[model samples]
Target: MKQILIAEDEPDIQELLCAYLEDAGYRTTVAGDGAQALAVFGGQPFDLVLLDLMLPGIDGFGVCEVIRRQSQVPILMLTALDGEESQLRGFGLDIDDYVTKPFSMPVLLEKIRVILRRRGLAGPESRLHYRDLSLDLDTREVLLAGRPLELTAREFELLHTFLAAPGRVFTREMLLARLWGYDFYGDERVVDSHIKNLRHKLGRNYIETVRGVGYRAAKADR
Candidate 1:
């Protein structure tokens, strides 16, 4: 069973998330404040974290930054802050997904399962090699002609999405749904930003844009 750390300041919300998640067959740990959340996280391993931006201390962003520095653990933020700036900031911090408050429990559960399932795909010996680029799923390590390439979690996952289906035209909307979850309702520029970054790191010739559409990794890059 995957363990989850749900950090929410409200007592009712905490119990709600905990009960629903457990009923969905996941082991859960709850933290009423950010400080307690950090402590619990440091002492134990969790498959995913449902963090709320409103907390007693060391807000969600702070905890996210700290955990990101130490591990690539998938973080799914739960915040009432629906503004684009806040959503972008969470993404910038390398969170896997962000869901605002007043979210549906069923949708939340689906998002959690999807993120954890994606995480589970990274096991020892899980790897993919295409052309001069090689990816070790377990480590989220990318290598181009044997040299390691550094990438943020989002960038890495984006790259995987393309490589996983070379030649498939993934529209911006498709990429957003696949990567950011269905609850995302912000500027589509987020996709463009990451694509630009990927092109820079993997070489401008790595991904091909289908002008007026989206992008795809040509088999030639394989």
Candidate 2:
């Protein structure tokens, strides 16, 4: 069974989240503070983490940075603060997803499911490969030229999406929605930024940008 760790200070919210996750058939561990959360995480194996921005001892961002330094476990940030700046900060920390407070349990559960699905831990292999480039969805590892390529969380997701359907043109808006987890919000440049970084690491010629449409992986023969 997939395990999840939830770090929230509010007793009521903690219980609610635990119950919902359990009902979804996920094994859950709960911590009321960031310190305790890190303790639990260090002591056990968890497939994912649901973290609140506000916590006693260490803040959520601190916990996230520390955890990221050690593991690539998917992290979902839960916050009462609903500002673009706060959300951008969470993204900068490489969070997989973010949820605002006053959220519905059903929506939260759905988000959890989506993240798990995207990670390919909830199902069989969803890997894609071409030439020496290989992406293992279950292991969340990308190997290029038989050597592992270290990528940020978002970059991995974006590359995975492209490799899943090679030769298919993906508009910038589509990529932003599928990988970034939302609509344009007047910031389509985010897709360009990620693509630029991905190409820089993967290969300048790996992804082809269609002049008037979008991007597609360069054909194997071409």
Candidate 3:
């Protein structure tokens, strides 16, 4: 069974989330603080994480940064703060998604399902392929033209996002939001720089520039 970790402080919210997740046929673990969350995460393997932004010991962003350094586990941040800054900060920390505090249980469950589906963990088949490019979501491996391509964590994420839905136009902001997380205050040029580097290493033709729009993967030949 897929395990989901919920790092939330509020007992009421935690109970609600646990009940919903359990109903969805998932194994659930709860941590009331960031410290305990980290401990639980270190001790066992979890398929997904539902993280709360506010905590007693360590803040959610700090926990996210630390966990990201050690693992690529998908994180969905829950916050009562609805400002763009908080959302962006969570994203910058590599959070997979963000949910506002006054959220509905059904919506939260749907978001969890969507994230897992996108990561290929909730589906029966966990592999995605397009043309000569292939990604193993579970193992975090990428291959091109029958050969493995060495990619950094960010590069892998960028490529994964693009390949998830080929031919889709993703603006720099969108890409940054998905790859860098929401609270990134850095230059938008970072996206261009990464694309440039990715193109140089992967192949110039692998990612196509849409000029005023953004970047996209080349369409597969039918």
Model 1 worst lDDT window (10 residues): 121-130
Q: Rate the local accuracy (lDDT) of all candidates.
A: 0.80, 0.80, 0.80
How do all models score by TM-score?
Answer: 0.55, 0.55, 0.55
Q: Any idea what lDDT model 3 has?
A: 0.80
lDDT of 1 at 194: 94
lDDT of 3 by residue, 58-122 (tens): 98998898899999999999998999999998998889999997775545655777788888886
Task: Find the number of clashing residue pairs for candidate 3.
Answer: 5
Superposed Cα deviation of residue 179, candidate 3 (Å): 31
Alpha-carbon error at 197 in model 1, in Å? 50
- Superposed by TM-score, candidate 3 places the C-alpha of residue 81 at a distance from the truth, in angstroms, of 0.5
lDDT of 3 at 37: 94
lDDT of 1 by residue, 66-166 (tens): 88989898899999899999999999999999999777665676577668768773222347676788987655789999999999877887787677666
Root-mean-square deviation of every model: 12.4, 12.8, 12.8
Model 3: per-residue Cα lDDT at residue 152:
82
